[model samples]
Target chain A: MTAFIGEFNCKLDEKGRLSIPSKLRAQFPEAVGNTLVVNRGFEKCLVLYTKEDWLDETAKLNAVDDFMSPDIRRFKRIFTNGANLVQIDGAQRILVPKKLLEYAELTAEVILVANGNKIELWDQAIYESELNVDAAEMSQLAQLFHQQRNQG
Target chain B: MTAFIGEFNCKLDEKGRLSIPSKLRAQFPEAVGNTLVVNRGFEKCLVLYTKEDWLDETAKLNAVDDFMSPDIRRFKRIFTNGANLVQIDGAQRILVPKKLLEYAELTAEVILVANGNKIELWDQAIYESELNVDAAEMSQLAQLFHQQRNQG
Candidate 1:
């Protein structure tokens, strides 16, 4: 099982097409084919998942008793709301949906942060500004997390 | 398929056992039995997932190609680092693992916030201090979210 990792810099052309770095492109499982699923992330970014992973996630939601809770219904709707299925072209480029682009405020310059199972597409500037914690802070966070784990 | 909803206030007895309010307990799907999965949340809180949902989520992670990326390795480790599988007792109480309790800084009082597929357990004081946005602010945040959704 290969998972996405490492950060990649890329460009979103005016026409909304993004060229996937060959290295990153190679990370996509062969079984995933050429299809990708684009959706709004929990944060202010777009989430890119292989169609295989996307289906697995949606299956869980489908199993939920939607009729039992409006909260669940709303969650399902929002989770899949702006989701789009895209294909990689001959140039290894995938066109992001206009709505998703706007949702993430993606512009000419963007970045892809590999988050284990999914890739987070962000406006480079926004990602840098919002997620710019110093190494000290990150270490502290990691330490706290590990401490709890060890203690537990 | 009934899902948990609404907020519930509960006490963590000295023994580290948390009694689930009957209302919230009623929301548990009968098929889920008494098993629950407790894990660290992205935030400084604990996430409670039914056995069914937990399996579904873990299945996706299990599908990842662990050898291809170190990020995935660290992620898998952290995500499941302090996870515990507990069960509801005859009195509807679940004993939180000591490590999890310390991780979330849980003392006597805690709040369970139903978040669609999972419930978030937070130390009452921390939750109130960190998530206590004014109604106006919440409305503003909601408006921003909806605007993006509508625009997209």
Candidate 2:
């Protein structure tokens, strides 16, 4: 498992294809082979995972004990059923399904991709507007990470 | 908004109550006054957000035009319907629904709270298994962020 961290901004072409950063692309060679799973992320972003990772994730979701709970049924319906397996073309691009593109508010224009353990794609304006990071808290964030690194 | 970034280890009692870090508590004054939303996050973690943020997020999901395609229906069912909103107690603790805890593979012992734009509560072992940083790709990730940050 590799840590996929950082942020990226790029264009989604007319056909809805966006390039995966080369570095990140290298991490998925095994499971992706050719196709990757792209799905809705928590915020206004898209999440991409290799086929194997997707299967592993969905298996867990499927293993939920009871479908009686609305949450479990809903989780199965949305996360599991709503996923799309797309292939990365020669240009390192994957076609963004129309529905997913709309969900993330991404157009053919600029898109922002943030690296978490998962990849999150967002519309440039919405990403900036929704991300409420404040300069005043920079030191606190830095300190927190510093402490974690020290503890680790 | 106060940035709550880092890792904090805490216990989720038998009753499903876990203490919120003081640093994170300071960032969600409104949530303290009312309720917050906790939902399933990617990477076997639970995501916590203020009511305002949750509403904003769900509204977007709700707006997905299900009439457009089968994918829309799937998205609506999973992302929107699976979500749960819980109120925080005076002690800054919220009950983790048994189902959600099970999804994240949490037990009575320890949980790891990680800071992203939102907080992710993860089982300690799962967090340890999932936390692998790729030092070899740091420069590439940095370059991507640099390019994106520099543009506009």
Model 2 CA lDDT for position A114: 40
Off by over 4 Å in 2: A1-152, B1-3, B109-117, B136-152
Q: Write the per-residue lDDT of candidate 2 for residues B31-117, one digit (tens) a residue.
A: 347577788875577888776767776777677677888987886677665478887788878888888988888885554343323
Q: What DockQ does every candidate get?
A: 0.02, 0.02
Residue-by-residue lDDT tens digits, candidate 1, B54-119: 766666655554443444444444454445567799999999877678879999999999978899
lDDT per residue (tens digit) for residues A92-147 in model 2: 88887776788788985555454544677778888778767788787788999999
Scored by CA lDDT, what does every candidate get?
0.78, 0.65
lDDT of 2: 0.65
Candidate 1 accuracy as lDDT: 0.78
**Residue A87 miss distance in model 2 (angstroms):** 48
Candidate 2 positional error at B74, Å: 0.4
Q: How much is A137 displaced in model 2, in angstroms?
A: 39
